[model samples]
Target: MAGQWVEVLGGIMEGSGQILRVSTALNCLLGLLLWVQKIRAGAARHA
Candidate 1:
């Protein structure tokens, strides 16, 4: 029973870690997209 509990906890920890990594990646992607848009807008204004 203890072993089963340990396994369950381990799985939950791994799942949470994976979710955190994905969220961080998505945030970085969004930031990059925003930065690109801002640059393009600035260029357009100068032109």
Candidate 2:
């Protein structure tokens, strides 16, 4: 999977920081790295 990337929606609706933290840990354990976007977007929308 060289030069490949996976997209994940990171927002309050998706379990917020908890999901982000767990996903990152799992990626690390699987020897893969990922990039996240729109962190806390839902919270921002509500605000």
Candidate 3:
């Protein structure tokens, strides 16, 4: 039982580390995409 607990916690820690990194990268990409769209919309409005 104790071994299972350790294994589960280790797995969660390892998985979450990668997920955090991926989510951070995805968030940045989405933010940049939104910013680009906003700029384009503003330019279109002006024109």
Candidate 4:
């Protein structure tokens, strides 16, 4: 019974890791887009 529980726990951990990685990647992409927009706006104002 303990071995079975460990296997289930391992599967959950694997799934959670995949979800975390995907979220982190999306967050980075959004941050880059926002930064680019801000820079462009600043340049337009100066011009």
Candidate 5:
């Protein structure tokens, strides 16, 4: 799935880390992972 992309919008869930983990795994199995607005859970921690 190289060169392919997947977009995941945040703020719909409580854990961005979980989202990242799942998305990363999916990316590995599927394609590229593009996470947008992923600061809804831990904005300051990410900063």
Candidate 6:
């Protein structure tokens, strides 16, 4: 199997400005997309 890697973007990482790459997995990424879809769907239902 190939190795998995997640790159941290941005040129600088200040004290509280660190963007950790934690959503690189398939399930983790899908969960985020689904969550966003749910939010949009709620707005559409109300509108």
RMSD of each: 18.3, 3.2, 17.8, 18.4, 3.9, 12.8
Stretches > 4 Å off in candidate 1: 1-14, 32-47
Pairs clashing within candidate 3: none
All candidates: TM-score = 0.34, 0.55, 0.34, 0.34, 0.55, 0.17
lDDT of 2 by residue, 1-47 (tens): 53356666776467577768876776766655567777677764543
Candidate 6 matches the true fold with a TM-score of 0.17
Candidate 4 on 1-47: residue-level lDDT in tens? 21121111222323545544554555565442111112122222444
| Candidate 5 residue-wise lDDT, 4-37, digit = tens | 6556776675577777778778878766756556
Model 5 alpha-carbon drift over 4 Å, by segment:
41-47
Name the TM-score of candidate 2: 0.55
Q: lDDT of candidate 2 vs native?
A: 0.67
1-47 per-residue lDDT for model 1 (tens digits) = 11121111222323445544554555565432211112122222343
TM-score of 4: 0.34
Off by over 4 Å in 4: 1-14, 32-47
Residue 4's lDDT within candidate 5 is 65
**Model 3 segments more than 4 A misplaced:** 1-14, 32-47
Which has the better TM-score: candidate 3, or candidate 5?
5
How well is each residue in 1-47 modelled by candidate 6, as lDDT tens digits? 23334333333332212222332343265443211112222222344
Error of 5 at 25 (Å): 0.3
